[model samples]
Target: MKEITPNNTNTTNNSKPMQQRKRKADTLGYDLNLATSSGGETAEKGGDGPQRRLWVKDRSKDWWDKYNSADCPDDEFRKAFQMGKQTFDTICDELSASVAKENTMLRDAVPVKQRVAVCIYRLATGESLRLVSKKFGLGISTCHKLVLEVCSAIKDVLMPKYLQWPNHESMSVISDEFETLSGIPNVVGSMHTTHIPIIAPKVNVAAYFNKRLTDKKQKTCYSVTIQGVVNANGVFTDVCIGWPGSMPDDQVLEKSALSQRADGGLLKGVWIVGGCGYPLTDWVLVPYSQPHLTWTQHAFNEKIDEILKVSKDAFSRLKGRWSCLQKRTEMKLQDLPVVLGACCVLHNICELRDEPVEPDLVNEVVDDDDDEMVVPEVALRSEFASKARDTMAHNLLHHNHAGTSIL
Candidate 1:
């Protein structure tokens, strides 16, 4: 109050707070360099201010070194990649031709082996893209791009070689195997559909929702159904996927390319055994569902049940080997079919190579109860097909009772 000048008054007012801040900084052992560098004006500038230093250790070299080292054991490799070293090498060799590096000056592209390993590891283990990226020492975008690219490459190159429908000679051999196993003659393959859960789609969300039971908890989940045809040895011969979960199995079958092929008489002489969820047709045979069953129907159901186990086993081993299919996949709606098809291709490869399935995986069950049987909009049954079914059933029953003494 006694002759206080403007400059002196302002200095006195700021002195106490500055002293207090200096004392706090000293007591807290704060890095004076951080404050001194820009004088804390950046913090006052708010969200657009300079970012703090973030130290991220690059572990890509670690993964690359371990993968390339001779010390990495075969068991470790199998556990990480879900395939033996020989199988991995075989895949690498096969995919190398297709997924080879592109000549680009902008940073070297990932090597073929590393790219294939990333995709296979993601599919085999169903790990998140972030985790797979970390494990492979790649950026998340890099991992994502590589996975889809490799999946496309695999589907394009290997589908014909590995996941094709059996030829006439192969169909004969497969039919013989089916007859030996279940006494079902002329059975080219067994067909079944399983649901693969997915995230709620942005468009047509209701179409993808289906009731599912998990841990005995009944809940509506979004899923897509995969209808597969497998041989007697649990090897997939045909796969039709990307159908909505809300569609019945029969309806999905009716909309499938296989159905079109059958309709065009491409499958005239061949019969595929299916469950009760399918429509009875000359090319596709389903077991009887009525209560008062005849001996022929009973015998036919028994043999069809045995043959259908191949499809069940195929799906079980498929989801079991690639556990990703058992859970809700994080893939985009459009990209899911390709990934699912890639899994089937890999499953066929494993089966063809005689890779021993895990003992626990042998008994794994795949749930096919998503959709109930609905009478198709268009009548799928014909007298000719019904007569063929009845004739087959009768023949099976007669063959069984041929050596018996019927009084």
Candidate 2:
């Protein structure tokens, strides 16, 4: 071995420490300048991967502007908004002032027309909030808020104007129309209940679960009932929604405000026709359920069928126009009622405006058979109502206007 000098020893010690540092750096993934130089050379030689563009162009503004332009054709407007341009403008004119007044104090608030348009598009198409937000160029949470706000406004303002209990004169007109349409006399309105499917509620999930098995494997679906009374024109005059699906139709009626009003003599002499799912009272008339019916009973049932068509058609038109009601809406259980109520209001608006119904929507209406709940003996014994039904049946069989055949 060579003799160890101080300088040599110092150099050897420094080299060992430097080598240990390099090894530690390598283990920790830290390059010792060689890798850095190699990377720089590769970049300069154009061997680096493609660079990603960071900025994306937003196209929502162009889409929205195209749809909302004044020169936009009426047909295109109808396709998007589900209403004619005239109707849309009318509604916007009515709602714009109030929406503007409400948003007067907020800076960077969305325009009223845009807000209303977004809400209507969401309701009309039943698109998801995320999709609608992307289409309208809005944040998801903002879209939800705008939808709720606009629906509340519609319920508050348009509902009273469009959907209201008919007064004496209005009832007379509606009754005359019904008689002309179906030969059903003294009919103020036709009543029916439809199930609006919903997501299972966090609270009282069982209450929302419909006892009627909707699937092949006996799986019960959840729904809420919307009991509506429509006039001969298929316009809803009275609506009672938010009832749990598990509740029977008669129970829903019994707990309804209409029932209370009818019981308190407020609806005295005003008769409304209901299906077999309802209890026959003096004000509410139902068809005879007994077997071996007479000619008069058969005639009565036929006329009742004709009258009930008004309600069925109304529901069809409603669900057709607002497809959201047809689907299981992804909304909170409590919020669903408001959304549905708004749909009803919009339905009446469309009907009053004579908006054309789509041909395919007519086939979408389901002819659901109601599971009749057993009525108590005491409740079924309505002698006066029974006599009223008999009298009407007798007249229908005898008169036979429009050559209505009982065969």
Candidate 3:
């Protein structure tokens, strides 16, 4: 049934009504009414809506007045701008001072510090050209050019001073060995090949890494060999890399300049201690005397072996960068060995100074066993070992002339 309610008693009118009231005369109690003057807009309190970012009132000046207070257009950033300007001026002053110290050539160009920084960052981080250019605010081409120039300068200036050849008196002990690489065996100082497996190029693949099985011998990958020499303290004195692994040690040694010195010539009277690999006559290898006897020779040989093992680990951990050397690029193959030798020298310098080796493992000595004297049939297959035995036999052919005269 439809019923009529009293005028003031209607359900819609009976509900509680919110009384409309004006904000009490600026309750925040600021000096000026900034909200109304700035064209107040509807703003959501929490939900997504337009925001009111009010400007604080100041007695001394207005917003625009305070912002552009002085004649300088950007008064807000003036202090920071001034700081940057002062830094720029200081750099200019330093450049001027440096230029004053120089003659004509260095005065009108890029500063020496920048060049040094470019080279140092390149060497230490091995960063690419674009990254270096961005960091130094230099052109990519400029960074590349500076790096090459600095490397060349270092090679020319520093190498001659620090990397001169050691005299006979300077080197007390020398250790030598041959390492196999790319099927070519080169008579090297240490056998720590750290076998870097390179993918065979498309052409002449077999020549680089032979994979075919032959009738009379075993199948082997094509690899190159590097021959190196280290001093008594474990620094590489010399290195000859890039002979094929298939090449015999004797052939590599015979052609090497070091071999010429070994033939009773340049390095006369110098005694070299070598493992069973090097075919040089002036070297002495430890004998398996009396079936794994704990003699002086055995201990010495063990020491040499330990040194090589440690050196290999150290070389493997080297963080140094290497540039691919190509013959077509007019780069010499010898430079690779030179850089390797430099690493070894640096290694030795660190070792001699009692600095910790990065590898952090000390060489361990194994217990001597009589079984070690047992020569495997593989010993006969080694050309170097066979030649050394033959040479020993030939040297033993000398007659006792003094005993004959006494008798």
Root-mean-square deviation (CA) per prediction: 10.6, 13.3, 22.6
lDDT of 1 by residue, 104-130 (tens): 542356788889988988987888877
TM accuracy, model 3: 0.42
Q: What TM-score, over all chains together, does every model reach?
A: 0.80, 0.81, 0.42
Q: How many steric clashes does model 3 contain?
A: 23
Query: By TM-score, highest first, what's the ranking?
Result: 2, 1, 3
Expressed as tens digits, the lDDT of each residue in 1-407 for candidate 2 is 12222234445554666556656754543423321121122111232442212111222556678888988998888778788878877877777756653333212467888888888888888888877876776656667888888888888788889889998899999989888876767889999988888878888988888766365226667899999999998999999999998887888898998999898887777689888778889899877777798777877888887888789789988888777777778888778777888889888888999998786875775534334544434455478888888888877777774225756
Question: What number of backbone clashes does candidate 2 have, counting pairs of residues 3 or more apart or in separate chains?
Answer: 0
Query: How well does candidate 2 match the true structure in TM-score terms?
Result: 0.81
Task: Indicate whether candidate 1 or candidate 3 has the larger TM-score.
Answer: 1
Can you tell me which runs of candidate 2 are displaced by over 4 Å?
Answer: 1-59, 101-107, 213-218, 367-381, 402-405
Off by over 4 Å in 3: 1-147, 173-226, 241-254, 269-277, 284-301, 310-407
> Model 3: per-residue lDDT, tens digit, 25-45?
223232221332233322224
| Residue 105, candidate 3: alpha-carbon lDDT | 31
* Model 2 CA lDDT for position 304: 87
| Highest TM-score model number | 2
lDDT of 2: 0.76
